[model samples]
Target chain A: MTKSKPLPSLIAVIDIGTHKTVGLVGQIIDGKARMLSFSERRTEGVVKGTVVDLEKLHNCVHEAVNDLERVAQRGIEEVYLTIAGPSVAGERVKGFVAVPAHDGKVTARDFNEAMLSAKRLEPPAGRATILYMRQPTMLDGKSVENPVGLQGKRLEVNFWRVTMEEGNVRFRVNMINAMSIHVRDFILASHAAACALISEAEKQGGVLVVDFGAGTTDWILYFKGHILCAGSIPVGGEHLTNDLSVALRISRDTAEDLKVRFGSALHRETDANQTIWKDGDKGVGDQQFNRGTITQVAALRFQETLEFVRKDVLHQLEQIFPGHAVKLDQNFLPSGAILTGGTANLADAAEASTNVLGLPTRVGIPQFEKEAYRKPEYAGVIGMMKAAIEDAPPPVRRPQGTLAWLKDMFRF
Target chain B: MNLFTRLRQFFSPRRDAFMGPADREWRQLIPQDVRRMPGDELGRKRAARSRLPLVLAVIFFATLGGIVWVSIDDTTAVVAGNGALRYKTDGFYPVPDLQRLVGQGKDGAAKDVAAIKADLEMDTQIASADVRRRGDGSLEIILRERKAVAKIASLPGSGPMVVRLVSPEGVQFSGAGYPSEAIRNLPEIIDYRTSGSGDKATIEGIEVAGPFLLAAQSAYPNLYREWSALSLRDCFGAQEDSPGSNLRVAVRRASQPADRPVLTEIVFSTANWRNELAILSRLDLDGLLRRPGITAPAYVLKLSIQNRTSARPVPEPRLVPATTR
Candidate 1:
């Protein structure tokens, strides 16, 4: 059946990062998020999600937003922003307290105190917190959905924390404010994307999300419907392109073109007499080069990236629980891992990730209407929109007047 | 030595100490000459508010005056013939011919705008036309022409059948001002039982059903290709006895496997075509061909009888043999 689309109010969301800038206009129809327009351009005057050159950044954002407004045939006044930079980091805090001393059922105040104990901290001098998620509470020795009426001695609450550099965020916010648009909220891109790529069942069973972009690779861990860790690495797919450029002795633009058209993360047998596209007297797309070399370079870099990402995740887990010896393998994890973002489209990227992490892995794409969710790159923006919809205030209820009351009393 | 003081000191190293927060380097995007006119603070403020509209008004009046002067001076222009006109203007009658519109044997002020509008309205093809004088004194005509809704043949004429293009406003044209594709592809309204001299009067339901046919044809051309004709015999009245004969439309069905075409008549209710087509779209017509005891080369579907959704196909009568086989 064809889905019915009603006229819906539009909401704008922007993802400004190191490699590219994207603007999206979305709407909520029948409580489902739908994308109306998508516009993207190369990053300008920005480094690792920080505004470095103000004038150039202004022009870049103005052009991106203007193009989206034209495509959607509307104006944008507010935006939901996504942040992915080196300064973004996640921490977990666990608080424990006795249930109560009295006989009356453990009051809601006791539960609130237990949960807020872990949240009572000033963000470090220049850092600002973005999100705090609470996991299912532990009563005595077992996890319980609600422990108010149950008899228990011990109550422990765990919260996942995400924070970023305050000055950097404010600078970008100031720039956006100058353009006459309000910033609704800021989210870590990987944290927001976890909502779109991972299902509730997978989250309850524990899953890992790895988002790969051109300049940065972000990872987030969620288990039991709550986040545990999230972080970003400085290196990403750009390193692979740079590696190919140097190894082939070709320009960066040509290397990128060749990498996309011929490169694969899985190696295959090469024909000794066969030659593939390389520069020559022939025109572009006619030039000849060795196809095997392209795949080899891609495979080698992918192997290195998988190893680095695995080590990073393992190291963060160790820090979260110093003495527990958390195993980063299939034996400990049941839901496995989901990969998303631009680099997830690389051939054999999922297989290489599985091999390195020792877990089942698959590429992740948002589950929305196909026309809107055409690519995995939209996972972050779509997730942010879902988050916005959940956060919107409820509709107001009007009071009935005396005239209506009289009419009901006089009904035949 | 305290933490707050030390943290403040560490972060404050050369953080644009002298310049204010609002001060940016690229604030000067305007050229030097433009900046010179609004050099000082008050002058810049005044120029920004006052000089813009003054400059715009000067430009607007200057352009408007130039066009007026050119149109008033030119005198050699005149309305051209129907050959020079873009659309078909054949058999012009109540619509004055080109000779009258061009004001032959009349003065220069002849052919005013209202007269031209009235003359154009006399014909069925011209819906409405906005006539204006161009900058070079020639008549500029922008027309909203009447499109052919269906090709209808109602009353008997000199030929075997009188087929004319029926417009949306329920007017007939003698095959004028329409392209060949329109004449060929428009729905055929043949075998219509009505009487009149084909004046500026309308038979009911033609205008209403016209839109539904156009929409159905555009939406489902492959399905529309199956129907050949519609016989409007007492279509306006409610039918109690012979409802099937009240409204008739021809259709073609293909027998499976052999893919042989069988022509048949389908009787349907006089509802909107879209609604009736929706009912037809949901019907499993092919499933009826394989029903028990159904063996016939061709048959008629009585759709108007029962639940219109379930059309019953009647098998053709077979001639019983006189001799025992």
Candidate 2:
């Protein structure tokens, strides 16, 4: 918000997921984002949305950040954190008030009141919280999508608010900042996942964001420009591979490789002819799994997990906008579901998800025109960086007030 | 009748059987050998020594007559533009500077005399020049042209180059300064090994005039009539340490207009004048001129031939026109 020109500054992101921790440094050079350096390492001490070992998690974040700093030739000051966990929660909250009769002018204070009323929902205990809030519609005696620069008698708000455990976010930020880097902003993984996969129009046109991460799947439904609902399922990509290893009695590593390289989630044309080569182990000679058998085993696990996710997403959508006759495959949402996250890379997952959920679907990679984000996996981290840069107050100002309010409106 | 008649003619002795009266006259022409006195050997030796000049005189007269006949009959008047402007009695006439040979004059001795006087004032070095007529109507020129022992290439834009003239002896004179004219189109001898203006050069022992003369003599031997200009540039010698010790001369061809050789580079060592001449005789100047491929001397006439060097195609011998001016 500083009117003074933004100096050539760097923004870094540390994405510490259960499977991997990645650090990326980007510079704003000549008004364009340029990649300065990037580093990634396998993560430990965290699994299934909870930190099992805090010390190990700290070390993982430290090593990746240090490498990024060295390669970028500059010390990292702060990092935008990407948070993904099962305790995160979302719901649609709306508020409305009659416009002042004499003045009939809806001021900035009125907008703030509506948003505060929406965040009034108390979070459950033992879960620290971070908020993703948005105002979708304004009804000043009439339902309007844009309230800005409009004269109105009454202002009503339709907004989506997501709350997650604040302790986990604080820990993640504090861990990175402990290495002398500040956590500029914390972005809930699902929203960052959604930003990477879907476009602005899809959110307005009713789309589902299914982020299939390790040990969990985060699902959010968007319709009419607001997140109608969000939910998480415990079964994710790791569960499917675990089920394969247990049922087939193979090594975990082999099960993972076979699942990725020879995995199929649907009975399709290519699946009919597919043959998976099984390296001889455990006294079993080299063998092959025909397409039908491999699909039977893989799809049995993946399909059931997807069914559970589909049911939750559908139940939430119906609860939010009742009597709207929102069929899972209804044409009201021209664009269907957008599936992202690491596990969504599985072959035919989109088709399998569409088949189980009875809706169209496609896999999504984070799309960034910024040169720093040439890789799609870094989408969540970069989204957080952008969010931090936007939220920071103008360096010359009091660091509070309407400019900060204006900044929030732009946040994903 | 035979015996008495024969005896009668023999008695008269005018009718000797083996001798005709004309033959007797020829016999009288041959004097009889006289027997010398016992101590006359010493006297006769002295006498022979005294008569030796008379014997040389008879032979000298005969040789003189023959030489005169050959000079008068064989030598022809050459109406060249340089020097006294008239023909030399001996074909060997000197045109100090060939460029001055350009001018028009009348047909007879009057015109020749005018050309002579004009030429006299032109070159200060010329002591005198004369035009003499031979018996065969060929003019003999007795020219004491300025002895510009060195020749310099004074071509309009190029720097001057020089060459040494080899006289009766192979030793070169390093006295006279650089000559700016005679070696007009000679390839300059350069030692690229050195820096600055260049090493001083000369032609034919007259220090300044020598280089131009050498260039003229050497290049003229292989060049055609169209020669326009010459350059003398020093090139790096094959050896590195002993700089200024080894040098070579490069000759440019007249038919080619470029100062540098466009066809072939011809290089010959200064130490091998005779060898260079030998190789020069083998150059087919006329053939090279006639061929469209021989564009310039750079590509064809490579004089840098040695035992270790690969043998290259030698053009046929050049039959240079015998105009020596």
Q: Taking the candidates in order, what DockQ does each have?
A: 0.01, 0.00
Tens-place lDDT per residue, model 2, B1-325, is 1234335556875643422212222112122222221122333443354456688999999999999876555344445533223443222223434224433445532345446456643543334556444455433555443332222322225655334322211222221333435434323323222222222222221222233335545555444223332222332222222323223333344355554334333433333434555666566644565565444334434343445344753423332222211
Residues A158-199, model 1: lDDT tens digits: 777677676666666766665555566666798777877887
**Which TM-score does chain B of candidate 1 obtain?**
0.58
Best by TM-score: 1
lDDT of 2 by residue, A315-408 (tens): 8778776887567874856788877767777778889988887779888766566555444356556555555455553223224458754654
True contacts kept of each: 0.00, 0.00
lDDT of 1 at A189: 90
Candidate 1 CAPRI assessment class: incorrect
What is model 1's DockQ versus the real complex? 0.01
Q: Candidate 1 chain A, which ten residues in sequence have the lowest lDDT sum?
A: A391-400
TM-score of 2: 0.49
lDDT of 2 at B215: 53
Please provide, for model 1 over B110-223, each residue's C-alpha lDDT reduced to its tens digit, 9 standing for 90 to 100.
676567767667656667766665544456555566666567765555657666877656677765535566576666765564445675646455644455456556776655
10 residues in a row with least lDDT, candidate 2 chain B = B20-29
